[model samples]
Target: MREVEETLAHNLREVREKKGYTLKDVVKGTGYTEVSISRWETGTRIPKATVLYNLAKFYGVSVDRFFWR
Candidate 1:
């Protein structure tokens, strides 16, 4: 639910930052727009499962790690 979505966003944002990627960089990696990345980081919208999977894969992490502790 909302908590899981928030966790996903938080983890994705953290991982992106740890890797020194700007939102624009993530957008290029995910083929999602910079606005979409911003929305996710800001908790404005939860990304689709496919988008999440692509992001996790792009970061070389499992989908489980993207949303869970």
Candidate 2:
């Protein structure tokens, strides 16, 4: 689970950077608070399944992108 969370955090940051988006940009795109997204990216908090799904969908990524090894 810790590995998954860490991977999620890395992936989230990477995905956002790959798209040249700031946390504010993601908030605008996903309607989640910047703080919430920040926490997720920092691995201080994990999103719920629904929230994670929404984020992946908004980013046009598969949910599997958030997990590995």
Candidate 3:
């Protein structure tokens, strides 16, 4: 469980970097605060389903990509 969460966090950060998006950009696109996004990236907080969906849509990736390899 912890491993999965860490993977998710790592993937989220990786994807955001790959897309050249700043925390502010994600905040604007996902309606989540920069602190929340930072927490998500650091594995300190897990996002709810709706937030995950919004992130996936904003990043142009499937939700599964956050979990699966």
Candidate 4:
């Protein structure tokens, strides 16, 4: 589970950076705080399914993108 979380964190950060979006930009679009986003990207916290869905939508990718390939 920890490995899965880490993979998700990496993927999330990668996708965000690839899209040229800052944490503040994600916060504005996803209604998630920068702290929360940071935590998620750092693997210190895991987002709920709905949150994941919302993030996927915001990034224009499938939720599976956050998982190991």
Number of clashes recorded per candidate: 0, 0, 0, 0
What stretches of model 1 exceed 4 Å from their correct place?
Answer: none
Q: Which candidate has the highest TM-score of all? A: 4
Q: In model 2, what are the clashing residue pairs, if there are any?
A: none
The CA lDDT of each predicted structure is: 0.83, 0.88, 0.92, 0.94
**Residue range 1-69, candidate 3, lDDT tens digits:** 999999999999999999999999998887899999999999999988888899999999999888865
* Stretch of 10 with least lDDT, candidate 4: 60-69
Which candidate number would show the highest lDDT if scored against the true structure?
4
**Candidate 2: residue 10 Cα off by (Å):** 0.9
Per-model RMSD to reference: 1.3, 1.2, 0.8, 0.8
Which residue runs of candidate 3 sit more than 4 Å off their true CA positions? none
lDDT of 3 at 30: 76
TM-score of each: 0.86, 0.90, 0.94, 0.95
Which has the higher TM-score value, candidate number 1 or candidate number 4?
Answer: 4
For residues 1-69, what per-residue lDDT tens digits would candidate 4 score against the true structure?
788998999999999999999999999998899999999999999999999999999999999999955
